[model samples]
Target: MQAVNISGFRPITTSVPRSAPYPSSARWRLPMKSSSDYGSCDFSCRQPLRISSSFSAAAAYTSADGETTLIQSSVGISDLLIVGPGVLGRIIADLWKKDYPGSQVAGQTLTTDHHDDLRQLGIHPISSGSNVEKFPNVIFCAPPSRSADYIADIRSAAACWSGEGSFLFTSSSAIYDCGENRPCDEDSPAIPLGRSRRTDVLLNAEGAVLEAGGCVLRLAGLYKFDRGAHTYWLSKGSDENRPDHLVNLIHYEDAASLSVAILKKNLRSRIFMGCDNHPLSRQEIMDYVNKSRKFDKTFDKFTGTDGPLGKKLDNSKTREEIGWEPKYKSFPFFLGVNTD
Candidate 1:
């Protein structure tokens, strides 16, 4: 299997440009552990970009003059049309609507034959469920390995689409043919799967999207709502090494926000990473969860298979180019640190 967690070290901050990105400090707080548990972060978020008050409204793409104009010019929300209403898809759509209330955003999903939900959410679902004909920039979060066929369909009929926007097909880091101990990053080079249908299909689909002018996002396991994988595993048992395995989970907030950020950056024909910067083994996580457990339920140490076929992914590109940093940047808080 691929390496179990993201390794190597890089300071998580950027050099301040004399002028500020926000009017004051970019007041965003990292998840706080109990004074007894997590005293502070182990990694360095030190770039002197620290500010106060507004984390969500801060800009990483600003200039020396400290103006929002430059940031908008470099990166701004783009019109987005997402495919599939899987957990990931729904979260991305919700974030887009919340962040860019004025932008045109619609989702193409497998119809549930009901208009009430879509109507209430103000989302347009192309329930016709026919092949995707056209879109400004299409994002496919479909899980099946054969989902690539849909991208091929769109490519085959490229003439139908305006051909100026982008297409971001969500793929997993599992394409690397990994094991349990070794870890991998974006530039680590993917191990050829020969004919691994799911990984292979993603490759073909990526080629088609790039050929037609778009980008690919090789993502890590995504967590959100109450359905988070880390949260599920953490709430399990405390067998010491119970949470000892390295974890690479991406918060749904970051995944969805990154999709919007990529489009805003106007990138084409490239790939980027989307995993949390903090690396915590499964053992440590489960302990934290059990200690913080609320409802008083008996916990069991979970062990079956090693883990998913994939491991960690590099996330630097998403931050440098797209100005997209995860809301939940650490693991314990990435899942356990719910804003709610």
Candidate 2:
């Protein structure tokens, strides 16, 4: 596997289980979906209708327009740990609570307030001491492209998993070299570029976690609440980067939902790419932005920074293997960009 980098709150909800028409990220934590019990299963092992109130392979879906929506079933972390309590980490922590009130998510950050935030979310804070004694199912929601030594940060966290339960490290799609105009699938080559050590840290981090019997999920570029790709363009008001740079994005909700799914399924030791299937061009997106937002989303052919971002990320692994199909296939609900 090559290395790429990628980059919640919890709220208490109903404890009652119900059966209804399955919308993609609908059921929270119902009960464990038993394949034999369900009597029928989807390609990815998802429980058929009336499967159970429990878990969703829930589906990790990527849209053609670049949206990542994860519909997961019920599962809780007896003790959940979220390392890197930054913006991304916070987002995950919030969503985790909404999906699985039963699970305990603890976020780790050098920041002092992170401890308080974790406490608020009912998550244990890992500021200094280790949870090795506790062995919480951990989720390292960190970006692979950030700090030069970011990989080391994750390694330090993995030191805690006692080779039990689930431990996931969030990675990126940048591991595949996107030269000009090419979309890379999970099976694509690890064509490295920029600061990514496709052969080193990115892969190393994934290997370390997996060696400990944990799972690795390679994520594509993400956008939500006016952040990341869409935000960048909104702020720029111009079409610069390859609008069609194979936009594979997951909504904030999908990421958290997928985590819930993994815990429910008790999965381990596999590589899954996180993204909506549809890849769009920057020009096409910018045009949409201008047409919809009534803002100047136009730009010259080239502007801002140009680094090696991967293209056309395949999220079929998530679907075929875990029965993941994201909701909000594109940033529509939030973007005012509709696709009917």
Residue 299 of model 2: what lDDT? 39
Candidate 2 local lDDT, 1-340, one digit each (tens): 3332211111111121122111112011222211132111111222223322244454443323233333243323355567766666676777767766555555555545445555665655544432123334667876656545554455555555433466777877655555555656666655332243343456556544554446777777776666677667667556445444546677766766665566556555556677777666666555556557555444334353665544666677576667777776765544677656
Q: Please report, as a residue range, the 10-residue window in candidate 1 with the lowest summed lDDT.
A: 38-47
lDDT of 2 at 87: 62
- Which candidate number maximizes TM-score? 2
The lDDT of each candidate is: 0.49, 0.53
Q: In candidate 2, residue 264 scores what lDDT?
A: 52
The C-alpha stretches of model 1 lying farther than 4 A from their native spots are 1-78, 129-133, 145-161, 177-180, 231-244, 294-298, 303-312, 335-340
Give per-residue CA lDDT, model 1, range 1-340, as digits (tens).
1112112212111222222111111111122112112112111111112222122342232212221111111112244556565667777777777776654455544444533465456555543223222344567677654343454333432222233455666767665544563666655555442445555555555444444445667777776646565456545543334334566778777788787677565555566667786555665555555555542543567554444433545567457767777888766674364423
Each candidate's root-mean-square deviation in Å? 17.7, 15.5
Error of 2 at 320 (Å): 2.4
